[model samples]
Target: MEETWNEVLRDLSVPEDIATKWWSQIMVQYTESARIYHTMDNYLRKKFEIYDIMVKDNISERSAFVLAMFFQHYEHDTNVYGDSIDKNVEHVKNFFKDAGINHEGLISTVVGLLGAACESGSSKEGIDAYFQDLELAALGASPDEYVEYITDIEKEYSNMPAHFYRSLRLKVLQTLLLIPKIYSTDLFYEKYETQARENIEKEINEVLK
Candidate 1:
């Protein structure tokens, strides 16, 4: 997957160090602790989404937009709002500002950022909130939830037997797929969901094999 990510970067002529910085920061932010929620291929695909959207919108040259997001200060990760939601919001705003996207409404309803706020009013809010806030809301998520996950992982990691580890990993991936769709916006789901599901299913099949 790193190779795929690197190849995308290279094809775009992204600097090697920029990729390295993004990689290190991503690992530290998402996988270092309790693994709030993560998937490298997904994130890389997001970069793909960003590039594809920019191309469609004509906001900026796709490669340039990719470079800015690749080195964006606030990460695009699985953090809930309270953890870095505001920062994530700010980051997207800054990206648009820098890229000359000029779409004011985007900041207000950024998918995976303030967009999760919508889940609060939906019938599925109970379940959606856990993942949305944890993975999407950025700084909007509660500190308590983050802390609890860390505490739980700490207690469990040392004694997590090999089989349990495999089961948990499979469970997480399966749970993500079980969701109606991984993306929120109609545009993204319509354009990317099918491919995303295929990628995820392929991964699961490989693991089971």
Candidate 2:
């Protein structure tokens, strides 16, 4: 994953020294002891896999899209909802500023995508839609994988009382199920819609029960 991340930085013409430094800092956050579900190996790496598939499919704005993915979860706070979005956006701005990468348009697009990540609706179009679907690809994983995902997330929030955690978790799942389509892109929708819905419903009924 580090090699692939460095390759992405190289493609963007970031200095190797700067890329190495940045990666070290990012790893510190991702590898924190409290990170069970959001670890680099689990959540972020899965998002990268989705990004790789999108790359093969010839998505546009590749630079901003990829950079956004790298920073999307750069700062996650399990105790808070939606706070990481703004922190990550600021982090991206400072990173680009420090790297002497003056492409404001690229930075703006990345920041916008980061903010868009918090949106509950998939009604967003184009790159935003793809990004939203990519962030949620786990929702459609195979049954066993989905169960593992749930368990890992539960572990991450273990600091909270089990009853409170389940209440919050149930509300989130119920909200996602209410969404018209969990995945917006035609590619994702066609491929994962049924399975994602089944996964969510099964979780709500069996696991949350």
Candidate 3:
């Protein structure tokens, strides 16, 4: 990992200090001390919390902050583990910001998902509409099945061996690459898919190599 990052750092050909900062940032994510389960569990908890938060009509600032946590939440809730959640959360936060994807509408649509869960929203039915709104690839076409796929995977993430976390992350990257189109909606496809793919490819290469 360090070697790859060093290669990237040198490729950028920046000043020593700038390269050092970038390397430090990359290494911070690479050296996260927590088992992936803790990070995954926090992500799940935040997702559930956001769902419950959306059930209410009035969303307070704190509530919105809670929602924001889905985008940037770190869980260091255990004394047993050293520092599991913060670095992982930091990596995600950086990813979202770097993705440059406008999430405003996507955020609003997700909050509406819990409500839509009943109508045609039973995971399968609802997710197609949801994904169309978010414009992720063909993932939403079969909503419930996709939901189950994700849920099952999250479950696996929580239980998988610590050494395999990188492998699991790679698997997910490969899955996305295999999708017919990364963004189902033409808007996202046109605007963000290329950069998104490049970012994923970089990470995928980092993990595999």
Candidate 4:
């Protein structure tokens, strides 16, 4: 049994399910590898605390994970982790699809996650000040104007991590563009309204974008 487990760990790139099991079984509490694994678990826990809030809903969780994988790998002009993008993205996408969600809403979901994550780390005073300006600006803009504003911001932040932040910004833009269409159009609104909080989603999407 120990030999079989060792062989599996040697192929560390085995499926996540297999990896999880092997780690759980072979890396017992007092072992050296187990200590390293638990340390990693703690790090992931801390990093994903904001992620948990962002993905409070199961659908959002799945989608955010998928989008993260996609951007982390396929985002253009990324300054970090460029060459390995394709392989990483493929690995992430496979993880998501393998985990069960197979679709496009993940982008929207991830934008919300990033927003929540960002907001969690900000001071109340800072967030209040930022939102005051944001609210005033939002009230005055049309959908196209909003998109233009986001694009401008996107351009200003040229050094953004394309996968994580930049891609998230784009999705937020897409959601903002999509909201008016979602609400004003009876057909589109009716279709998605039952499942998603259209107005809230729109507002949150806009704020993040």
| Candidate 4 lDDT for residue 195 | 34
For 20-95, candidate 2 gives per-residue lDDT tens digits of 8899989998999888999889888887887777543656787788788888888888777587787888899988
- Tens-digit lDDT track of model 4 for 95-123: 44554544456534443333332132233
lDDT of 4: 0.38
| TM-score for each candidate, following the candidate numbering | 0.33, 0.92, 0.31, 0.25
Q: Rank the candidates by TM-score, best first.
A: 2, 1, 3, 4
Global Cα lDDT for candidate 1: 0.45
- Give lDDT tens digits, candidate 1, residues 65-142: 333333332453332334454565665555446434554443333434343433443333222233232233221124
Candidate 3 accuracy as TM-score: 0.31
Among residues 3 or more apart in sequence or in different chains, the pairs in candidate 4 whose N, CA or C atoms overlap within 3 Å are 71-163
Models, CA RMSD each: 12.0, 1.7, 16.1, 16.0
Cα-based lDDT for every prediction: 0.45, 0.84, 0.42, 0.38
Give the poorly placed runs of model 1, Cα more than 4 Å off.
1-165
Candidate 4 Cα deviation (angstroms), residue 83: 2.4
Clash number for model 4? 1
Best by TM-score: 2
If ranked by lDDT, best first, what sequence of candidates would result?
A: 2, 1, 3, 4
Clashes of each: 12, 0, 4, 1
Give the candidate number with the greatest lDDT. 2
